[model samples]
Target: MLRYLSIIFCAATSFSIAAQGVVTLDSCRAMALGNNKEIKTAELKIKQAGYQRKEAAAAYLPSVDFEGAYTYNQKNLSLVDKDQLLPVKTFNPLTQNYEYELLVNPSTGQPVIVNGTPVPLQMALLPKDALTFNTHNVFAGAITVTQPIYMGGKIKAMNEITHFAQDLAISMHDSKVEDVIYNVDAAYWQVVSLKAKQRLAEGYVSLVESLDNDVKALVEQGVATRTTLLSVDVKLNEAQIALTKVNDGLVLSRMLLAQVCGMPINDQFTLADEDKETLAETTLRPATFNMDNVYAKRHDIHSLELAVKIFDQKAKVARSEMLPTIAAVGAYHAMNPNTYNGFANKFGFAFSVGAMVKIPIWHWGGLSNKYKAAVTEARMKQVELDDVREKVQLQVNQASFKYQEAYKTYDMTCKNLRVAEENLRMAQVAFKEGVSTSDEVLKAQTAWLAANSEKIDAEINVRLCDVYLSKVMGELKIY
Candidate 1:
């Protein structure tokens, strides 16, 4: 009784653990999307694109800058003095009249006489240093503002290109999300399929064990040969080995699912039970496909469309580069020892406003060639867009066909499972009535196991095909 109680307790603990670890498909997809490295990188790309768009928009606004500088000169500036003359007037004692010295010769040391009397003597003057500049500390500061009046549409085109690039990043992020969902779905379904196969393997082992017991009893009663008992033992051993192998596979499959869901790889978990009958019923339901509108739903196609728009903007930008640009500029400057107003050695403020125009002149045909190259690139992007549309349609069609095929295969396997179950039942009845051999019973059991395994695979395939089809159609939504 104690042993039985202990077994029950252990069973309950395991069940509780499994119950706690149970996860749904949607939960796995959400976890993977949150933890996937690629998804995180794509999100970062979107943010970068947003920053670039803002940078482009900034070009449309006026720019203001402040500048300051200080300098020291080695020598002071000086001004030269001009030559001058002065009249000398004095009363001459010998002549007793007022005389003015008109001229004086430096070499002769005599004054010239005017009207028979000594006139005023002219004295020569030499130049002397008059003005000087302070060379110690010079400082200047300025605030300048510039607004682009006309850039030949270059700024507008660049802004549009950035906007288109942002859209492209969003589309690429969406595409990455879809890929993550598909991978999670595949791993989740694989775990489910392996669980089902493990159950079947356990059942097979039980059946073989029962057959071995019956054969042993028959051999003791002389109703069956020892060889029969040995044969049953061999089948039992093989079944047990197969069960062990299946169990290992199931554990690995669960681990794989855990890894995909960003959980600890060694952590054991239970999958939520899937309703196979309901899945089959839903899968068989008819669905309409609108191939014409499918391309619009594809993220890749959206990305390509945005690429074309970006290229178109590039062409406009290149052409604009060949045209003239115009701008309005204003500046307010102050400097120590201001010289523009006067010869004052003090700080003074001055302001100026003006307009500027830049025209593209001779460039050795460089501008024209660049414009032509841009046009060619735009055309190339258009071609790529067309190709992607075609490819998206093709992928959709192929996925549709594969879905159909998966459904048909699942149906066929379902029928096969029914037949195999009935065959196993008949073999058991015949073996009890002594109308069949142990070998025949073993063969039936094997066939039944094979059929069940195949049916599980078929079911998983159908589900995966559904996922693929939705992915190709761009209709898969995992929240």
Candidate 2:
């Protein structure tokens, strides 16, 4: 019972969430831009680049650190006096007497004196005590200010690279948005077109059903032959089949729309009447396009430019490794030893500032190799930029040509639809006046339906090609 209640509660919450959302083309685009996984991932990369840029900017600022350490060390100190081992002599300058003194003679077993005075000979032995140290914790805090005196332009170059990376991220995001907008427009319009086709098919089927009833009634009245009734039956069957096909197509189109909206296919949805009309009238001719402008403004091109900048900066950073980096440093420390200072804290502090230069003397060709690779990558990006520009030009040209063709087809189809309508009307009146045969009327009706189908197809193409052209021109969202 509790599990069922929990399921019911979840279901209610989901329904409430879904009820708040209204699906429109603009709304769908906004939702996809905000919530689509791909777009969201791209946005996250942009954020990451932003943080990296911030980190690069922060490099120019001062830094502070708090450090603490606990040390337990033991040491012993010993010293020997070498002066005691050497022989001692006494000299009297006034008496001019010089003599050596010995307390005992090994062979004579007697003391020897110099200058009528005996001096005792002795050796002194001393022991220096060993020092033991206990654990001593040292806590110190220092505010270190690192003002970049010079970095051989490496820091500034890196910051520029990071800024370029941020720009690249933004461009990538725009590229993804363009792609999503195009895809969604395709799906949304496809579903709308399919729905219109389905309605047309249903209308044809209804007309066939009415004709079938008339044929049956005529056959019963002995005015229509069995062959004529059979013909009408065949037409009815064809119309039913066409309707079935269109219904299936509608279902599929709805599924695709759901996919674009990032919703479940099981969700029930339909296009608004105004949306259907608006989609039918979509055109791209008003959008301005120039191959040169497109090449200059393409997001992909901008992204590549940023990539080249980053690679160039990478080369600069590598070159910086070969130059000397100078820094000034100062330190202070305290010591405590049991034997030396009776386990008392001896504190000391020192302050000094000096420049240091570290010259790179030799490497196993590592720096050279890295610099070479960076240069190669930067060069490759330049070639890639050209290739992408060519491709973008081709896309724009192709889309423009296709749009023109679709427009022509739409115009021709409109004229053909009017002719088919007149032909169908003339055939119906002639059959009613007992001049044209049922077969002729049936043929005219078939022609009219086919013409209508062609017009619908042409219109669909016109709208789709317009979307394609708009996308190529980078104006999918703008218009």
The lDDT for every candidate, in the order shown, is 0.81, 0.71
Name the weakest run of 10 consecutive residues (lDDT summed) in model 1. Answer: 274-283
Query: What lDDT tens digits, residue by residue, belong to model 1 across residues 1-479?
Result: 24224434543544454458866676677667766778779878888999999999999999999999999888666564444444656787999997774667678877665787655545545444435667477888999999999999999999999999988987898898899889989988887777777778789889999888888888899988999888888888988888898778878887887787667789776667542432434436345677667777888888888988998899999999899999999999998878775546788899999999999999999999999999999999899989877787888878888888888988899999999999999999999999998889989998999998888888889889889988988888844
- Give one digit per residue, the lDDT tens place, for model 2 in 398-466: 888989888888889889989999998898788777787778878888988988888888887897798
Best by lDDT: 1
Inter-residue clash pairs, candidate 2? none
Candidate 1: where are CA atoms >4 Å away? 1-20, 78-131, 274-280, 285-288, 341-343
lDDT of 1: 0.81
Q: What TM-score does each of the candidates earn?
A: 0.83, 0.80
